[model samples]
Target: MELVFATHNRNKFKEIEAMLPDHISLLSLDDIGCTEDIAETADTIDGNAILKAEYVRHRYGYNCFADDTGLEVDALAGAPGVYSARYAGDQKDDKANVAKLLEQLKDKESRKAHFKTVIALNLKNNENLFTGICEGKIIEERRGEKGFGYDPVFVPNGYDRTFAEMEMKEKAEISHRGKAFKALIDYLSK
Candidate 1:
């Protein structure tokens, strides 16, 4: 009744852990004897997620999962699909990535975009993949001071505040990760 979340981000682990039921104990790379920094070079979220899940499950022999997310903009034709994390350059700084995104869309008008999250689950004897998307638009300026990543600049559909402006519970109720995790839980139940 335990699973490993094949990611290095403590924040993401916490978020996912919050959604998991008590019967399912969620562990991470730190829990195993692994510390290697694997490269996420896959062109799509699904590919990258599978890579991580398979890698961790192969090495640790545990029912594990990995999640990869991307921000796709209709106007930019998904300029930073796979490279969303390192959009600015080699440094995966969140602020730098946001700055680069804002600069690129400064003069553009169509700010429509969507945040997509893909989760790849690998059991010792089976595999599963799930995807979820949250539609939103990029604002000209950043708003609020909560949340992380693209939360400050991207406002969800039918809302005036950015993800950063919403409480953690609020965001969890209507976030790309939330949607994807909900789908994953549903799949697990069946």
Candidate 2:
């Protein structure tokens, strides 16, 4: 079966693609000629994922899935939750977002945070939602060269290093997106 993963990020596509079975073929937004940026105007992660998945299903007539992830900090009152991507600005600069988050938590004691990923799948005109969360704390500074978004400074619980410090396979085993995709893949296999 062929499915479109509604995203332009090659890193994200590659990550999920590696987890898929040989029977299933994955396609990106580019592969389907979907160059236009899908607007994520929803107030919540679930809503955003649904919006993107539905948009592609209706507009391009493809079986697709889209995911929205957020970094919610306990000290910030769950801030930067739905607005994680553009937290620093509309530019969606990862470095700027991390810097802003670090600055905001500079004086705070509780560094508790979690990464949440919601994946919405539109298949055969039916919709399904899957969610995964990785609980951790934001470190004082960036740590690794791998991974993207807030991975450099955000470390998963029970781990000394951040997501960026871990290899792709290691990070996927414990990442929010990884867990969510696991559910989605299981569903697809059935």
Candidate 3:
């Protein structure tokens, strides 16, 4: 089956594409000629995912899935949740976002945080939502050179290394996006 994954990020598209079964043909937003940025005006991660998915399904008439992820910090009162992408500014600078987050938690003792991913699938005129979460904490400084966004400083629970430290295959096995995509894959397989 042919399906579109509505996203402009090549990294995200590649990560999820690698996890799909051989029977499925996954197409990125670029492949589907969706060059315009779909506005993420929703107040929550799931909402944003839904918006993106619906946009493509309605405009491009393609069965597609879209995902939105956030880094919610306990000390920030769940802040930067829906605003994870543009946390530092409208430019969506990853380094700036991490720097700002670290500065905000400088005086706080609790560095608790969690990554949440919400995927919205529109297939055969039906909508499905899947969510996954990874509980972890933000380190004082960046660690590995892999991964993207806040992966450099965010460490998953029970692991000393951040997501950036792990290889693509390894990170996909335990990441929030990974878990959510796994559920999506299972549904598609059935």
All candidates: CA RMSD in angstroms? 1.0, 0.5, 0.6
- In candidate 2, what residue range of length 10 has the lowest lDDT sum? 15-24
Write the residue-wise lDDT of candidate 2 on 19-131 in tens digits.
Answer: 89999999999999999999999999999999999999999999999999999999999989999999999999999999999999999999999999999999977999999
Query: TM-scores, in order shown?
Result: 0.96, 0.99, 0.99
Question: How would you encode candidate 1's per-residue C-alpha lDDT over 18-62 as one tens digit per residue?
Answer: 888777788888888679876797889899999999998887798
Backbone N/Cα/C clashes per model: 0, 0, 0
Rank the models by TM-score, top first.
2, 3, 1
Candidate 1 Cα errors over 4 Å, as ranges:
none
lDDT of 3 by residue, 1-190 (tens): 9999999998898899889899999999999888999999999999999999999999999999999999999999997899999999999999999999999999999999999999999986799999999999999999999889999999999999999999999999999999999999999888
Q: lDDT of all predictions, in order shown?
A: 0.88, 0.97, 0.95
TM-score of 1: 0.96
User: Model 2 Cα RMSD, Å?
Assistant: 0.5
In the predicted model 3, the residue pairs found to clash are none
